[model samples]
Target: MPYLFTCPHCQTRTEVEDEFSGQSGECVVCGRGITLPDFAPGASRPRNQAPGGSAGRRKRPAAWIAAAVVLLLIVGAGLIAIARVGGSAAQRVRQGRERMASIRNLEKIAAALNAYAADHGAYPAPAITDRRGKPLLSWRVLILPYLGEDELYDQFNLSAAWDSDKNQMQMYQTPAVFRHPNSQGWGSETAYHLVIGTGTLFPSTGPLGPKQVADGATKTLLVVEGRGASAWTEPIDIDAGATGGLINAASGVGLGGITDGGVCVVTVDGRGHFLSEATPSMTVNALITPRGGEPLPDDVLD
Candidate 1:
């Protein structure tokens, strides 16, 4: 049965399930010690209980120690507060926050790209390569100045390959703006990427400007969010001909999105949108090409 439970310290009331009866833990609201009362729905409140509880509840930690579970509430920076009520609820809260965070990262990256284009007349080239046309540095390295990491950018040897001994340590200095909130222990890896191919905004031939996008700036795909093994400095991008904008493609390609059960994309107009897993392959492909002349699905924006 569900019954109203109140935290002794803060007097915050919640209608909780009977499964948590007799279980003790930190208060979900005020982060204080608490224990759930074991009772049925119609149980009468004792004399000093909530709604008319005594004033000394906050000062009485010893009264709760026998019942309060040994749990601590750690407030993560910029993350949503967790609920211990159920496993699925906690997971949902965590995933939603991660999706929002990844989208914000893409927005910052988009702003940097636009700033670069405003100054250079086009987005940075897909890669900085050697004289023999071997790829070295990613365009991510090219936009460091715009992302406010000028010192970290200067540390890189532009002429050397990303893995070259001269540029090795710089690979681990990925800026916070380029890193997804959930990426940990990956060591300077980034989930953000550019889609590159003949028909995409980043073509192997050259970087395309606003005037080159036939479908209009608001409709062109500029950057995508995906998990990859590549370091931020690696000159790797999703190949449109290879991946085709499908979320969580089957080939084990790194473009498998960062958010759980979701994909985030930033258009050439510097706006970010979250696409659900139910989004059709055709809808994703339509958004990938700037010159496809395909009309976007009406509900994609919804």
Candidate 2:
């Protein structure tokens, strides 16, 4: 018959043969020295033994419980770290898709401008003014026919101001090319704008023909993506006089307002280009001019 015994050092229970009674040896589980009590075949219990030998078990030590808790905490922290990294990667992918959509919108607008230029000798003026010189409509309204929005354009009262009672209703009917995919807020406002000034393409004085761009059509900037949204018909755009430095997209200023650290622009040749925010202010100024006669370095376009 086998008798049960408990190891004092490790609290492990084991069965031993009756023949090993009264013998001294090392504990099987803990490797500690221990002695077995002598047993009589007919005796109900051992001479100096407790009522229940291994029937009732002892509770685990505090050390074991603490180790289990520590292991659980480590696993939880690892899971949280994985979740955060996954969320950041997903956000980056979403931003990249929006940037591509914005670029496509700029390309479409460039195509419309080119078509308009082909019919007319020069590009549209920054704004259309009445005989008294009061601003009425923006160049955005001038290219309506080329943009396949001739019906919407015909509804505008070109004689009255863009925000006039009749035209105000049409203000909410913004064209798809003017609104960026990532832009927020209400109204038919636009994120696309033109850099208008004395030497720029869309000058306040008058529109310039392709031949007038002495710097070459591909070198002159026609339109740019700006920060804030403006009513599509409003004569609002970037002022060359105000933009004296590089503007990053994160800053919501001049050049890089729509993309990360860069801005997408359409040149007079109907091609889109992404200009880094790190581009020198002088190089940007040269690109904006129609006939400044400044020599652009080969690396400036890179």
Scored by TM-score, the top model is 2
TM per model? 0.70, 0.74
Best by lDDT: 2
Clashes of 2: 1
TM-score, candidate number 1: 0.70
The lDDT values for all models are 0.74, 0.75
Output the worst ten-in-a-row residue range by lDDT, candidate 1. 69-78
Candidate 1: C-alpha lDDT = 0.74
lDDT of 1 by residue, 1-302 (tens): 34566668877555544445566667655778666666654464444343432234333333343233223222322233333445678788898888788878888899999999989898899899889999999999999999898999889899999999999888887788788888877487888899888777887788887667787677677888876878889998888777755687666563555676767878888888887756777777777777889887555655
lDDT of 2 by residue, 1-302 (tens): 45565657777555554545566666544557766676455433335444334323443332332332344446657888999999999988997787778778877887887788778988787788999988888889999898899999999998989889989988989888888887776668787888987788877677787778899878888888887766889988888877875767345567656677678887877777778888888989999998999999765654
Which sections of candidate 1 miss by over 4 Å?
1-85
lDDT of 1 at 283: 70
